[model samples]
Target: MKEKIEQALFEVRPYIEYYEELKKRVEEIASTTDEEGLFIKLLEEEIKKSEEPFKTDLRIFLQKFTSFL
Candidate 1:
């Protein structure tokens, strides 16, 4: 399972990096009151995109990801 996880991570590295970048951008937008709605929209879109692969156990994935950070 560990090896399979590693392989999956290798394949998804680009997506991870992209998501990280988007997260950073979202943080920036979050700081501005004028674009609060846009920030939420962007966050929703990002979550929606991530939900496909993460449908099996969304809460578990979030917990692990938060711990890693």
Candidate 2:
């Protein structure tokens, strides 16, 4: 689970670093909500703009992370 979560974060790292809006959203979510719910909501929003592999990866990460929550 830790590995999966790490991979998910690894995958999104570049995007979050490149996009100020995405970074802000992540920071806001982190500040306002729990980790599992935060990632789920953020991934749901990001999935719309994401392509293959990462989109699927985020969904899987959300599913796995939700189980821990």
Candidate 3:
């Protein structure tokens, strides 16, 4: 499970590094809550507002991550 989550994070790392809002939200989630579900939900919401390739990448990431749950 840890490995799967890590893999999901790895897939999303570039986007998080590229987007200020995403990076900030991830950091905020990390600091405020240990709930992975909330983190995934927030990411899904953010992805809905994103454009093309990035949105697709994030959706894939979410699908992979949620599969573990």
Residues 1-69, model 3: lDDT tens digits: 446656766766665534544445446645655688777777778787878756765676677688878
Worst 10 residues of 3 by lDDT: 17-26
Runs with alpha carbons beyond 4 Å of true place in candidate 1: 1-34, 52-69
Estimate, for each residue in 1-69, the C-alpha lDDT of model 2 and write its tens digit: 345455545555654423444444445545555556555777688767777755565555455456555
RMSD of each predicted structure: 10.6, 6.1, 4.1
Task: Using lDDT, rank the candidates from best to worst.
Answer: 3, 2, 1
- Candidate 1, residues 1-69, lDDT tens digits: the string is 233333433444454534444335444544553443454454455566654444323333333333432
Give lDDT: candidate 1, residue 5.
30
Cα lDDT computed for each candidate against the true fold: 0.42, 0.55, 0.65
lDDT of 3: 0.65
Q: Considering every candidate listed, which one attains the maximal lDDT?
A: 3
Ranked by lDDT, the better of candidates 2 and 3 is 3
Question: What is candidate 3's CA lDDT for residue 18?
Answer: 46
The local lDDT score (0 to 100) that residue 52 gets in candidate 1 is: 46
Candidate 3: segments with Cα more than 4 A from true spot:
1-4, 10-32
